[model samples]
Target: MPDPALLSIKDLHISVGSRPVIEGVSLDIAPGEMLGLVGESGCGKSVTALSIMRLLAEPPMHIDSGSIAFGGANVLDLDGPALEALRGDQIAMIFQEPMTSLNPVFTVGDQIAEVVTLHRAISREVAMARALELLGRVGIPTPDTALTRYPHQMSGGQRQRVMIAMALACDPQLLVADEPTTALDVTVQAQILDLLDDLRRETGMAVLLITHDLGVVSQYCDRVAVMYGGRIVEQAAASDLFAHPRHRYTEALLRTIPASNAPGTELPAIPGTVPPPGQRPSGCTFHPRCHAVVDACPRTMPELTGEPSSDSLLESRRMSLLELNHLSTTYPGAKGAVVQAVSDVSLDIAAGEVLGVVGESGCGKSTLGRTLLRLVEPSGGQILFDGKDLTALDRHQMKAVRRDLQVIFQDPFGSLNPRHSVGYIIGEPLIVHGVGDQASRDARVDELLALVGLPPDAGRRYPHEFSGGQRQRIAIARALALDPKLLVADEAVSALDVSIQSQIINLIAQLQKRLNLSILFISHDLSVIRHVSDRIAVMYLGRIVEIGPTETIMNKPQHPYTQALLSAIPRPGVARQKRVVLQGELPDPTKPPKGCAFHTRCPMVMDICHSVRPVLEHPTGSPTTGQVACHLYQDQA
Candidate 1:
């Protein structure tokens, strides 16, 4: 016999100011089970999770219908005192961003202990002791010292651990984790997910994990529920859902993932964006973008039913356009120490080729990009673009050279001026470079906007008037205004939703091919990197660990760090691979390890790795025409 459901939601209907948000949604989470609720942004995943705990604000948000029952008690009907007791006691939540959720004025210990003291009648000292135990359990290093530090003092991974510890303080029967690892690095994300799985087994608690990442859902959850505009489109066991997805929306969503497509090929992006809440089409909300849509799809919403569905060579003959010869960047740290952000990295990109730089945070990929563009002055080595030494150029000379180099940042809105119209934002580069008069520049702006798939009339609107994907398109138009030869995109698509991300990615790829442009694509996501890049360079602690053709690196990575990164990525519709979990967090940049910076956490580290740094070279018996820096290859060579 199976256990009864710990939390049950039946035909939930949520509304914001008479507009429907979540409609006819039902889900169940049994004790000791992990269920994943997935959908794009504004699809009511979070609202459903919030309603489970009565966390939604009233007036603006109201439950139009349905019931959420936890352990035979109706959560929506609970009074103030009962609701307070229900929260953080039998049911707990870990929000998306821990920095915003944690109190800035309080220490880690004080914040965690408050949860304990509020839920249980425990002394402050005992609560603090329990907090320490949780910190340790969640894999935080030096828990005794961490308890006294502020949220900002610790790294992102450590801060997330603190949030997890606080959620587990009361030993809740159910845990609601909402996009908890979305902003984390791949390795850190793996660690957090593994920790949750272990804790679930030990505590026998159910988890409702809400995210848009199908990969994470496939790897972690036992049961999966697919959410579309305000409704449950499909629900099944995780394996069954991935192997035999019946919903057209689910099938299209899977197609958008880069892993499901080939390298340097156009991704089959879903046509339109998710419609806004009061403006959704009559019948199926996804019908507008569905390739297999029928006349009936636009008039009738489908019922939830059981379904089954299916889902760069760097070393070539071309001349190099951009070359980095032992480029380095350093900044002064506390106590007169120098932080090596980019260390002795060397690489080249050919004309019309896309070179991807990938690694965890603080691995110097962004720094390398900025340094090569002269945005951040290099500390050593040379940047050669088209046979000209960028490092030796004067300020006036570099200013002229800027016409050929441009960059697109992660936050499109942050880079764009909210006060300016789209026309002015895109034409300002032409104006600054004195490429043409006002009329000609205005004409160029319209052409550029059209090139990026936006209409000429979109120029009159401001940045805030557009969606996230539209804003990114505007940024791309601005970056291409000068017709630059080299484009540096730094984490450009990391912030958008999955469907929107696919749109932007396909746009960039098309532009790259159409314009014959060379791009330096920097991101932490290997899957995205694989799709757009001809070649890849893996970085760790300011050094390139491996460089190779896209297929070679993905299929047969030589370096341990590269292998671990590849293993950490969650693959939809594929069985979970044995992850090469690195031991500890990244080391201090100001005071890196004596020899190899990765030696401390590498799974295949040897005695020589502690004293001698390995040179980047091709390993014996390997089929890749790539270079790797590791003693495992060096010893074999």
Candidate 2:
């Protein structure tokens, strides 16, 4: 059943410096449910969140015309005192980046206590006690000691928890969480997600979650609203939207995420960048970059409909391109401790595909890719490439296959040496494989640079001389130099901005088709995985709990843990309610849970989950449903 509206906005028109930043936007947030707002960066997502709190500053910006209703009262029309009363006492918010939101100089405890006392009229002693309890409720260990610690002293995850505790301290009916987990590690992100889910069940508060990630929308939000140029272009129930996104923009978003089934399908990005506010085109804002764009799309806007065509209705589905069999990697930790990153995980990748692996920091997505290339010795497992056993090859023997395999790492600048120019970096690979000498290598480097959308002369520039995006281009050139069939990318674009990230993703896509190079793109970004991979694998501490086609895993994630991790991505450009942001911290890898790695934080945890760990198994009814290890899929109730 549809939830009743808790907050509503109509004719929302906002601007910065006489420019229309948000235009004619309207949305609804229902009671005890989350509405996900999503789009790319600068799509007015943050601005919309600010407008809800009546927090837009003057001069450069203002809400020209809009009716923002909270508890049936027009919040935009409220006076300062009335608004302040509503903020903590009625509606609370958790902004993006808690480090910036928190006062660094003050103790975390005092900050939270201040909110409680100011809103509740409680004594300082009572407020402090309440603050400590809230802290504890948010799952912060040593809540009392944590209170005295400053914002800087705490990790990014802790600060977020503190922010949540403070927001909830007022017992507000609405919670607005804006990209709360964008910068967190996988494990920390998992803990935060679990906590948020718990809080939502307990408080019955409405949640408005804003983010750019579709996976989060699929898992956490009951309904999703996709934003483009400050307007909702698409919205529907989470399952319906993910299963059958109407707008071309929404479909493109789903395609961008990496998957586990198809190991190296090139990620398809929406063509072109999201235009800046000032430069927005007329009619349908997404028409400019949409491949399925029609002549009418440029002159007429598409409305947010309740229905859209499902993916299965499409004429054809993407085929697979790569595969991994019995792949395993064990890393040695302190004092004889062995951390099995990818333990005997076997999966296949068909022609022209991407298999996206997702999990917390230590979940082994990156490790699996490395072990495939023998970068890390697989203690046990078979890595078959085109029916040939990779495990049998020595470094020298593997060198023959190295020309068909490549790797792109995160932090491109760190990967390239400062002393050598971009030309040298890309050329080194060609020279190593005896393909070309100095002059030929130089020519090849220039061609590669041009292929990656950089100028020919860019080859002469030093690593430090270019921006993050440009350096990454150089890194790609280096990876492609060997002209390998497979490319392994380890957190390749996580540190980049949205605009730059899209550009890099597009470049990779173009290059992949042109060269037929299979890629192992690794990252913590679920949206990227969805857009890129044909299939997705959700990893926990080390094992992959869920593996399925992109549509299945994303639209109806069988595993509870997969659902939570998907709920963590930040959707940009939409205005919706926040969710149980997420809960708790990642469990310790050295001291993992006894049975299911995720059982410690699982929402639908069972008794057997704590004693007998489940293996990566396929559903009996549908053998091709892909592999999911969770007991949820086991019973299929």
Instruction: Quote each prediction's TM-score.
Output: 0.51, 0.49
Candidate 2 runs further than 4 Å off: 1-322, 573-583, 620-624, 635-637
Q: Which ten residues in a row have the lowest lDDT in candidate 2?
A: 307-316
Model 1 per-residue lDDT tens digits across residues 455-547: 889999999999999999999999998778899999999999999999999999988865557899999999999999989999999999999
Give the Cα error of residue 364 in candidate 2, in Å.
Answer: 1.4
The candidate that wins on TM-score is 1
Report the alpha-carbon TM-score of model 2 versus the true structure: 0.49
lDDT of the candidates, in the order given: 0.87, 0.77
Angstrom error at residue 583, model 1: 1.6
